[model samples]
Target: MLNAKSEIQKDTFEPASDNLSERSSILTEMFRKALFRNRVQLVGGILFAIGTPLIFRFGFDQLPINSSALSNTIVGSIFALTCGFFFFRRLIDYPGTEGIAYAIPIFAVTYGATVIVFLFLRLDYSRYLLGASYFLTVVWFTCISIGMVRLRTLRIGIVPGGSANALLSLPSVKWREIREVSEPTENLNAVVVDLDHSFPTEWERFITETAVSGTPVFDVKHLRETLTGRLEIEHLSENTLGSLNPDHMYLRGKQAIDRVLALLVIVLLAPFFAIIILAIQLDSPGPAIFRQKRMGYRGSIFTVYKFRTMRAEQVGSVDDRDRAITKAEDDRITRLGHFLRRTRIDELPQVLNILRGEMSWIGPRPEAVPLSMWYEKELPFYRYRHIVHPGISGWAQVMQGHVASTDEVLEKLHYDFYYIKNFSPWLDILIVLKTIRTILTGFGAK
Candidate 1:
């Protein structure tokens, strides 16, 4: 087993081709380094997108330039490209960010916002220039993404033992097992070890030396969580629970934003809401709105609202946990319910809950009363998820979908815990993107 494992490690981290002696010119080396730096990429891409247009329109006199139009174009293009660049950069730091797939939509949103602002202010702007800027922004970032993927390699050295071996199965990283303290570390981006396991004196010294030399040392368990986007909790402790506490300022700020946005949405979609209500009443022969008591923030039970999708006569007892769980293709779901549930349009009414401070736009999904009670009893530290206000859409909803079985819910709990552990705007943004995809694909819908 040892020999076979060694063989696999050898194949995984085959040395790069011996071409180090062939040094390029000084200028070329500097250019190569600068090309890979993210700051350089951001500034350079913006300049290329904006400068090329200015030079074409004014420098070459290709088109008659109006000063107001020129000024608006320059400011708008810079704003859009800069915002898009940073947004893309921050999102890629999180797990599950699809390479280059977000480029077009992100740029579209930034540029679209710029256009909205322009129209709102009734400012003159050249559509052609802005359009070209948008196109070039996507193209430049796409090229940068392709180049980085081809040029960069994440090679991690593993100190073989305990859970360290578990990370070897994860893809998107080159794993090299360090069998001896004498193993080379120059090529590795970082080193990982099972910190919970005792190490020999030499291996302990090696870990110290590696860190002293400026290489990052990571715990195998934490690294696994980072790579997999799940946090496994086997026991409860203050240190463990302490780390899961979200930023309170962001929490408060998020609540305010959620309510404001909810108000805006309710006002904007009022007409559409009426139409859905009428349709639901006609289809299901019951109240257009379904209200249920749900387990909410800090163990509070709150009334949650949704467009009625299930048949009225099929309503089950509130104490029945089984009925609270929506099974796959259940007969209780009305025809409109299928579409509403599939598209998550059923969740629209929950904006009122957000307005009421019982929920946010994103967080853990609150379970029905009985299911929540059952889970708290069955799952250890399950109530920890209530630290933040429940969300209309959540990390678990986007990642794992709707789960009914206790075993499946256990896994979903891990996802929820992971969200709480790494709670921030970036993760929320990623969830929002994933939620969009989920809606389109009808994933995790009952």
Candidate 2:
């Protein structure tokens, strides 16, 4: 148990462990391939960053004439690059006007920062320049947003059976432009067929022809993974689990970075931490900190910490499954507790866990021991997420929001598997940024 807990405390820049040496050689190639896969977006970002200021300078001399052209160009360039980063990094391309909503906050911050800098320098501010830049950005981004929606739209034809029904029912389908139909259409971008069930010769020919034509044809199970960002548990097998080769270098580096970041955040938020402690103590009779045994890396059990958000209660047995899950309207939550959970102030104490080497700043969230034991019994390949240290925030938490109940856990596992298989610094960065949005919006909080 101690060995497992200490895995995180190891030097970040050093090789992970003896166990990882065999895999390190291939890990770099895999990450290089994944991170560089979005080369078009990368190139586009650079071009826009360099080109936007020049175009604005030509069209509207709103830029401060006295300031160096380079200095005047910095704000708009930063704003464009920042927007493109978050917009293009998403795994699921949100469709339609709703997709634009995601960029609003990013724009506000970057643009606001630009204005603040101008005021700080007491430079001659040009309202025309600011307004012109804003107008040009909206027009530019609107076109790109439409293109993104169109690109995400996949005209999929699936035989009516197996995973088809479930795929159609998911709310997540709205994130992409997917249109599933019973019959194969000439315009289909892809085709999904269940291998378990037999289809007519005509259907087989349609699938074969689609493949021949270079339109991608996918197995129903693989399509589920692609669409939902989770491994489909119903079809999970040993072969699938065995195929996962986690990048040890990336994991170790992420851990080192997480610890350093957690320490810095803890130091910065120290004043807020004291205020929270006092509030929790005044609002409830229990201790300010709550700790419970959670399944950690390699199934090691460790105590996880959080601010107390419920009334004082005795610890229960591992078999106490009924009381294990936190419900949406749980009455034991105090007035301050409700506020804490909504804003995620309740989780601030977990920085200690990160510092202690039991958790990362990002990964699969740890499940309580009782809940973990129950899931192990109920779900196949449930323990696979424990391949890495549990996290304070994770892919599932940001994408699916807070989950409860067996059905939700099953769904959450899909995302967890996706994270495990696709682990990269880019995905972790996305999770962290989205988590901030989730916290501010009070999304999925009871």
Candidate maximizing lDDT: 1
User: Model 1, 366: alpha-carbon shift in Å?
Assistant: 0.4
Candidate 2 residue runs with Cα over 4 Å from true position: 1-68, 71-101, 104-139, 146-153, 159-185, 195-206, 235-238, 314-319
User: Model 2 Cα displacement at 264 (Å)?
Assistant: 0.3
How do the residues 1-446 of candidate 1 rate in per-residue lDDT, one tens digit apiece? 11112111221232334564434444444554565676788888888888787687668655454578878888999999989987887776655554476788889999999999999999999898899899989999988777655555467899977789888899888889999899878767678999999998989999999989866788886777766777878897888879899999999999999999999999999999999999998886989998889999999999999998899878677788888888999999999999999999999999999999999999999999999999989988889899999998988898789999999989988899989988898789888888988999999999
Candidate maximizing TM-score: 1
Error of 2 at 184 (Å): 7.9
Roughly what TM-score does model 2 have, to 2 decimal places?
0.71
CA RMSD (A), model 1? 5.7
Model 2 poorest ten-residue lDDT run: 3-12
Worst-scoring 10-residue span by lDDT in model 1: 1-10
Find the number of clashing residue pairs for candidate 2: 1
Residue pairs that clash (backbone atoms under 3 angstroms), model 2? 230-414
